[model samples]
Target chain A: MKLRLRGVRKSFGSKVVLDGIDLDVGEGAVVCLIGSSGSGKSTLLRCINLLEPLDDGVIELDGLDIAEPGLPPDPIRRRIGMVFQSFNLFPHLSVLDNVALAPRKVLGVPTAVARVEALELLARFGLADKAGDFPDRCSGGQQQRVAIARALAMQPELLLLDEITSALDPELVGEVLDVVRDLRQSGMTMILATHEMAFAREISDRVCFLDAGRILESGPPQQLFGAPQHDRTKAFLLRVIDAGRLER
Target chain B: MQQEPTRRQRWERRQRRRSIAVAALSSTTALVAVVLAVPRLPGYRKVRAAFFDGEIFVDTFGPLARAFLYDLQIFAWCAPAILMSGMAIALARTARSPALFPLRVAATVYTDGVRGVPVVLWIYLIGFGVPGLLQSRTWSNPVLWGSTALIVAYSAYVAEVFRAGIESVHESQRAAARSLGLSNTQTLRHVVLPQAVRRVIPPLMNDLVSLQKDVALVSFLGPVEALRRAQSFKSSLANFTPYVGAALLFLCVSVPLTRLTDHLLQRERRRMSATAIR
Candidate 1:
């Protein structure tokens, strides 16, 4: 499904986090949103899923205006799955249960059917063995993979990855990125809010550079990363490269 | 590197020390107090005989046994009612609505006030004051009044317990449920409450144990159950033997429940630790 955001604005009290932002996510395309901390990258992704209410904006998913007043957002949200930074797996539930929860509870699927689907998704993420275990029993990478699997279990047409690797240990980050890379190869459309520029550049069909709640520049990854059109994008890229080198 | 002591080993050492200290202190104190109080024992016996005796034991114990049976009957009947109402109220309040403010206030007042007041007073108020106002002479069954008071008081406390349990679940869990398209009520019933209730099992068991012991407080109005039987037996024999016997009966009933509570708590702790390790 195509996602279009026009003139989206959101603020918490007096702090304007997202200011008159516009972007479009084409069908089956992986779009990476890059920005510094508190630049509203996460907030914009949250707005797309309607997790955060937009103060003013038109969020259209497949021609349906999700942000239209008095319209129910549930149908829009069901098609848009979100993976949080914390890999928000339900600690009390088993891996299988976490993945199966949305399907069984929301879609009214039978337990057996949900389990079968959950196991298939887990198998894809190589977490089938961990299905009976609680989320706390899994590594950060495994948990994030399960989170991805959980989103996939909803059969979501659009997936939102909100800095999924940000909370992982350095060694664990690659495993989670690999899962997303696999999802890309499988043709699952995704919007990724990330600091992993290399992975973003590698996997993203389009890259949008956001700064201070506005899109600085957006285009194909090669054009945006290798031959930037904005000086701000170049400065941001230099800072990220320096930070990445320091981490290494 | 040396391995740390297992939890069981640590618990065992702590238990040993506590039991030894309790035993030594209680034995010494009991011996000294008994020696000093022996001279006054005869005076106490004389006073006790005046107010209580064998016939009183017969009069109270017999009827108390009957009343206890009645109390149990009432508990069985009202347990489902209390649980259903308490759960419904708790869910309604947590899910948030215009009614939440008043419901929460009422719940807070009911639990805190009723729990703080002596159950006997509540029994008196419900049985004597309210019924008297209604001009219902048949409301004199202390057993019914006592059970009603217990249910009302305990339900409030349990409802709060359930509310806390529901709230203890992380907000993320609710968000995940909502993202899946489950309505607020469905999220509560399917996602939030199940996990919350599981976390609260040990505390719920503790509450049940407290409820069992509190059943004895209902003995104030008349000999309704075991307490009355023991009191009557003491009066008949003009000795403390029956009271001692009744105390043993209470211990018999409550001891297993206390042990069950401990067992459940230990199990929960283990489950938590296992989860934490992951």
Candidate 2:
């Protein structure tokens, strides 16, 4: 699905989080949104997934506006999957059961079929054996992989991953990134809000830098990262490199 | 290389053990002195007459035990009624839909109004009031009316406990559940409530333990539950031994429940510490 947002705006009281935002992602494209904290990267993603109501503007899925106030989010949300920075897996559920939950409950798939699909997803994610373990028992990286599997179980047309590996130890981040890499290879449409500039540059077809609740600039990653036009983008890239989140 | 305790450390350990033993001996001696001197006080005879008689203690046991069986039956119906109604009321109170406004208002009113009154008043008002309105001789049974009163009053308190549990679940779980296309109710049933119930087990058990004791208050509405039977024994024999007998029976129920709650709390704690965010 081609996801598009136009003149989108949101605010909490006096503070505006997403100020007249506009963006577009083609089908099967990987768009990485990079910004400093509090620059509305996560908020923009949340608005697209309908987790937050839009204040003003249109969020269109394939040229059809789905952001109407009366439109129920449940059906719209089924087409959009999201992962949080903290990998909020259900603690009370077994990994397998967590993976199976959405399909069985929302989609009305029978338990046996859902579990079979969930186990396959678990096996692919190298979590087949840990399927019976609760989320707390798994490592941060493993838990994130399970989270991805859970979202994929819904077979959403678009996926939003908000700093999925940000909470993991440095050594554990690669496992989660590897799963993202595999999804990218499978032609999955994704929007990622990330601090990992190098990973963003490597995987994203287009990179968007957001600042002060607006997209500062967006273009091919190589041009944006290597020879940025915007002064703000340049300053941001310098800090990202100094922090060693980009290649020297 | 590891070193064993030095001479000073060994002496300190020995001194600590010695002090503990001495403290125990002193406290025991003091307690015994107080116990022995009690008989010399003027009130001692009355105390002995009321509580220390073996014959009255023995005489109170059988009737109180039978009445306690009646309390057990009351508990069987009341506990489940409180749990089910409490959870439903709690869910209604927490619902955000504008369409459910009236229900939300009613649930809030019910919880606040019922909880504010003493349970005893509920026994009087509901126990006597409902039957007075209906004026049905068959429905006027005190046991039935009393148990209903207890359920109504306690369910309000338990509803708040249940609501707290439901709210304690992290917002992230709801976000995740929503992203999965689960409806609000589905999210609560499948994700939030089960975890919330687990977290609330300690507090919920505390309510249950107190509720078991409250079962005795049914006697005030005029049924022959254990406390009523024990009070009758006090009137007839002029002794308080039957009260102790009733207390022992209550301990029999409350102690096992308390231990079970402790066990649940420990397991939850251990699991929580494992995943505790640094």
Candidate 3:
């Protein structure tokens, strides 16, 4: 397994955001977390990246317990790159510099070397022409792609995507999903929190249904999406189907 | 095809011109009234001879202008120190580590203590008290101690301005930087400070304007700067025109700074409104 979470628990004040989240991701596996809004999907991704301190339990990466006290999170975060739903690219930097920043600053790469790598990544994402343009100049879809490229520049072992498509317009969604599809084909391990049921069913190797901060069900995407055993999962999928989000 | 103005548009244009005419007439009348009334007051000639003596202004302008260079010299050194120490203090105050609690407290106390005391009193205390306590000739240089006083007092104000700018940055920016494995210092240096500093440039320019003017206050320590030179002429020559000359010299620098601050503020506002559309 590349990543493991055993009994991960997190709370904000009196509200429990992630209650006993236990999961595993094998090498190059793509796991999709499907849930309604406020089902702890985002918080789970944040905790996994160590953005938020967990209230309880352990998260292991490559068999090493990273949840131990006094463990500096920077190294762990470098290994686990995350793309946020809001596409938080640094607005002050150009798309190229946004991608190059972590490599140059955190990884100690030379400026020219980082720029070369960043330009290559931008070209791969169809953003080579936008290398000099700031994030505000790019469309939402382009910004999100640049954000993904930025996360990938660190060459992370595992990538956590927190509802990466949730903020995108319908017409722009496919481009971003295409990027995810390419990453999967390139054998990058990923955990995605997504609202796009069709994309999750198409791309996910394994699907987990979360409700009220717990994993309600988990299995192959077909088994879980087509034949949900739990009532909550079935009800959630039914609402999604009724909303025309999932093509039944 | 350019269309002619509509009736309502022409009427509004005429109204605007009339309002501008009225404004000009009223302001001119007020100015003429003040100008005509002031000279008619009893003993106006004596007051004018003492304060507006053209001969005294011509005689002292050269010396006072040269002395103004001392103020500029003090400002030149103090400005950089103020910026660096102010930023350090702001960072110290914002640090969240349990271990840095004392540092945070000290920063708070330093800002509060320095800001609470009047800048003039600080000049007196640091300039005179420090040298008196040390009893060293090197330390007794009024220019050195006076410059230190300005730096100490002004840095406190500048630090508060910096802290406000830093706090204005959204927490999500910090979160995004941290998620990329940037350490706290790296996030601050790369992500936070750049945005914060850009946002606060207008306000910082305002502070620099104030600092430029206040540099003359160091004349209290008896460095023969512009204000001191003006004071000496006032006492020895029994005339105040050198003070007026000094005021004009100070305004020469400060007015430009004020105009630059306004230009930056307008540009910043325009940038904000443009981005807000996104």
Which candidate leads the pack in DockQ? 2
Q: Write the per-residue lDDT of candidate 3 for residues A108-194, one digit (tens) a residue.
A: 999999999999999999999999887877889999999999999999999999998889899999999999999999999999999
DockQ of each: 0.56, 0.63, 0.49
- Give stretches of model 3 more than 4 Å off: B1-51, B261-278
Per-residue C-alpha lDDT of model 3 across residues B1-278, encoded as one tens digit per residue: 99999999999999999999999999999999999999999999999998899999999999999999988899999999999999999999999888999999999999999999999999999999999999987668998999999999999999999999899988888888999999999999999998898888878988998899889888888888999999999999998899999999999998987898787777755543325433
RMSD per prediction, one decimal? 5.2, 3.6, 3.4
Docking class of 2: medium
Q: Point out where model 1 deviates above 4 Å.
A: A245-248, B1-81, B99-118, B133-142, B221-223, B268-278
Query: Scored by Cα lDDT, where does model 3 land?
Result: 0.92
Please give, for residues A106-132, the per-residue lDDT of candidate 2 as tens digits. Answer: 999999999999999999988899898
lDDT of 2 by residue, B103-206 (tens): 99999999999988999999999888998999988888988889999999999999999999999999999999999999999999999999888877888888
Determine the C-alpha RMSD for candidate 1 after optimal superposition of all C-alphas.
5.2
Order of models, best TM-score first: 2, 3, 1
Error of 3 at B15 (Å): 13
Question: How far out, in Å, is residue B138 in model 2?
Answer: 2.1
Here the TM-score of candidate 2's chain B is 0.85
Q: List chain A TM-scores, every candidate, in order.
A: 0.97, 0.99, 0.99
Better of 1 and 3 by DockQ: 1
Error of 1 at A101 (Å): 2.0
